[model samples]
Target: MVDTVYLIKKPAEFPIADLISDNDVLILIQDAVLRQPSISNWYACKEDVIARGIKIPDNKLLDYEDILNLIEKSNKVVVW
Candidate 1:
């Protein structure tokens, strides 16, 4: 399992998330999770939502428990 945390402030960082998500599960944490048009079937960290003052659309948001479960199920975890 590989986990990548991208806490940068450049648009280039966005693609890194997408690329890693192609094969591995991408967990968006901190500010990176606030962006819109979130990836399909991906998980977003719950704490990041409140910290960023961003409302995670119901359709795009998942509970931390669910995220944790996914992590346990996945063979790899990537954060960006």
Candidate 2:
């Protein structure tokens, strides 16, 4: 199977990074966008991060269009 996008809203809600497989992608939004963890495929919402004044490294931001692309790339997506 292809990778999945684990859409996380709250930082504390996620268990541990070990639970997510290397093929899985962790996408943070809302409050979770600011708190980044050391995950392999980590992506945060561009607009949400900007609204919260969070400075993320280059190429890490995922806009709405980018999100749609990610959804298309993945076999399935799960929101947490």
User: Which has the greatest TM-score?
Assistant: 2
lDDT for each residue of candidate 2 in 1-80, tens digit (9 for 90 to 100) = 34888888997766477778888888888899868887657888999999999799868889989888888899889888
Which residue ranges in model 1 land beyond 4 Å of their true spot? 1-12, 15-24, 37-39
Which residue pairs show backbone clashes in model 2? none
User: What TM-score does candidate 1 get on C-alpha atoms?
Assistant: 0.56
Clashing pairs for predicted structure model 1, backbone only: none
Model 1, residue 26: distance off in Å is: 2.7
lDDT of 1 at 80: 39
Prediction 2 global C-alpha lDDT? 0.83
What digit string (tens of lDDT, one per residue) describes model 1 on residues 1-80?
42432232322345433465454555566556655434554545666677777776665565667676666766654433
Model 2: worst 10 consecutive residues (lDDT sum): 11-20
TM-scores, each model vs. reference: 0.56, 0.86
TM-score between model 2 and native: 0.86
